[model samples]
Target chain A: MIRFDQVSKRYPGSDEALRNVSFEIAQGELAFVTGHSGAGKSTLLKLMAAIERPSAGTVLIGNQNVSKLRPRIVPYMRRKFGLVFQDHKLLYDRNCFENVALPLYINGVTGQEAAKRIRAALDKVGLLGKEKAMPITLSGGEQQRLAIARAVVSRPAILIADEPTGNLDETYAAEIMALFHAFRQVGVTVIIATHDAHGISNIPGKMLHLDHGRLTVS
Target chain B: MKHWINQHTLVWRLVLARTCRNKLATLLIWTVIGIALCLPALLYVIIDNLNQLAGEVKHEPQISIFMKLDADKTIVDTTKSRLEKHAGIGSLQFVSKDSAWKQMQDDALTDNIATNLKQNPLPDAFFIQPKDHAPTAIEQLQHELQNWEGIEHVLADADWAKRLYSILELGKKAVWVLSGLLGFALVTIIGNTIRLQILTQREEIEVSKLIGATDGFIRRPFLYAGALYGFGGSLVALALINGIITIFNLSVADLAELYGSSFILALPGWQISLGITACAVTLGWLGSYIAVNRSLARLNPH
Candidate 1:
């Protein structure tokens, strides 16, 4: 479970990124954070992942106060969430299997066991056959799917994506959303940030809409 | 424990793969480090060999104790017995005044000078070889002999050996100073290499951190790379030193033959070789640790 009580984030020489935001999502629930560009959606997700601390608030992931967590423990705490960046963030130098193996390797999983899980995750993203192909050679949609495979490879309890389908076509975006749906069906909590309302209209999930660093609707 | 080992194994494999990817650059770095380290190591080997040569040249230092001219046979006998009883004296030969005077007369150069003397003016003497060849020990023995009864003077011509010892001491110190400076240079070289590696892989590191990779995880491969570079460089240095020694020995053999002596340069002992390797590896690890930590702190500013 994730909870945020009056969380606020401010950057120096800039206005507040998140203003007294409060929200909660139950475990195993799929939620969408909908907002325009620069609206606090990414900041909220960052706060949830403990990548950035809230300026003033209590952001709790499960029972841990992520805002006050010690710097040394931040990495271990981050292991709870699988993050997919807007640009895929896949390591282009390595092949598809290696990119997907990153999270598992971070978690001390390797050898045959890691290979098994990596293949399964890649298979879920429809990238099972291109395990040895380089990311630079892959199509944009394939790259996005590879990123998703990497995100879920470690079987993180919470999956967080920042505009994961931002550059994808409608067909690829729908396919990506279906992967999230499948993950949600298996009790993996999924959180996606996007401004594409029509693409997510048919999907049934809780929506948190943000406007100008304030949560407008939940 | 199995998982921990597996993790390290995986990181090692990754580091090796990455290192092999840039083969020429890695080799160049190793060569630079090797040359830096070889300077000091070669100096050490030469100094060590010189010390062995000095030890071989001077088997033992001897002290000559001369008796007073008025001292008689009983005094000579007593002095000889005392010298023999002394723990510091390894061996002693007593030369009576009469025999010394006769030996002087028997010598062609000193015979004429000795015949001019009316009586045997030579004093009885005891030639003593000290058990300890150290300059200080020999000087101490000479000092003790000087205070003995009926002894006119004690003379020890250990000045040449003493001078050699001091020079060797200075050489050893120079080796130490050079090693320290080169060790620091090696650390800096390795640190810069790792820093560049981090820069080239900045995107990978950033993405790894975002996906829950610990700083340790990101640093592991770089650290291993540094250690490997250090290890490889040390090996090259060792090989370089050995090759030089071999070449030097060939000429040394001809020179020794001309001198009617047999001398060969000895290779560095296993301990020194092991020490060099260990020192290099530790420096490599330290270099990478410092570089990676600095970069990580900057990348993830609090």
Candidate 2:
């Protein structure tokens, strides 16, 4: 569960990115945050992960106030969520297997056990066959899938994505949404920040709309 | 237990991977550290040897205290008793004028002088040995004996020891100053190298931080890499010193013969070697810590 109560985030020398935005996503629910560019969608997700602190707010995940979490505690707080970026953020030098195994490796999983879990995650994302292939060689859609595998490898309770299908075609974007639905079916709380609301209008999920740093609809 | 081992192994593997990624650059950095550390290490070895040489010189220190020519048997008796009670005089043998004259006749160069002199010109003297032959102790003893009654002069063959000791003192100070300078240089070298590594791996580091990798976890591999560089460099420096000692050992025979000594150049003792290694590794760790922490602070993941 995630809650944002009157959370406002302001960068130094700039206006608030999120102005007193408040919303809540219940346990095991999937929600899409729809907003125009510069409408505080990315800032909202960043606040949830404690990546950016709210200038004035109380952002809560479960029972913990993540907005007030210390820097040392931020990483442990992040372990609760699986985060995917629009750019994929995959290491180009490493093969698909290494990139997908990043989360598990960070959690001290290795050897045959780590390998098995890494394979399972890759299989879930349909990237098992491309384990040895480099990210640069993978298509945009496949690269996005690889990033998803990396995110879910640690089996985080919450899954958050910023523009999960930003660079993909309609078919690929639909497929990516389907992947989110599959995880949501298994009781994973999934929240995605996207500019295109029409892309996910047919999907069954709550939609939180943002306009000019304010929560227009939830 | 299994998890702990796995974690350590993963970090070590990553460290090696990163190090091998830029092999030439790593080698260059390590080479620079090795050379930087080698100078102080070599100086330490030299100082150790000099101390040993000084020890050898300690055993050979001799002094002769000459009595005034006009002093009578009472003066000789009083002087002998006074010297016998002196703390610095380890052993003493009285040399009468008759024996001094006879000793000159035994030597080919001084035989004619013994016969040419009508009376014994050599005064009564005490062939004295000090408790310690260190320059300061010998000089203090000389100064103390100069004011003794019926004493004409107190002479010691300690000029060479004094000069060598003075040089060794200067050398010790130089070693300290050099160690400080080289310590700074080593820290700078390792810090700059780690900074470059952080810059190159900024993307990986940022992504790692985002995906639940703690700052400590991200820092582990880089710290190990820096430690490896320092540790490996120190080992190289030790090898350089030992190699120099080996070369010097081979050539020291002629020099030892010239000095009537059989002393050979010795490798630094285990303590000194361990000290150098410890210093180098600590510097490496410290340098990496500073660089990593500074860069990490600049990168705001939140």
User: Residue B21, candidate 1: how far off, in angstroms?
Assistant: 2.1
Q: Highest DockQ among the candidates is held by which one?
A: 2
lDDT of 2: 0.89
Docking class of 1: medium
Lowest-scoring 10 consecutive residues by lDDT in candidate 1 chain B?
B55-64
Q: iRMS for model 1?
A: 1.1
Instruction: List each candidate's DockQ score.
Output: 0.68, 0.77
Query: Which candidate achieves the best TM-score against the true structure?
Result: 2
- Residue by residue across A84-189, what tens digits does model 1's lDDT show? 8888888888899999999898899989999999999999998899999999999998999999899889888999999988988999999999999999999999
Give the Cα lDDT of each candidate.
Answer: 0.90, 0.89
Off by over 4 Å in 1: B56-93, B96-156
C-alpha positional error of residue B12 in candidate 1 after TM-score superposition, expressed in Å: 2.0
Chain B TM-score against the true chain B, candidate 1: 0.74
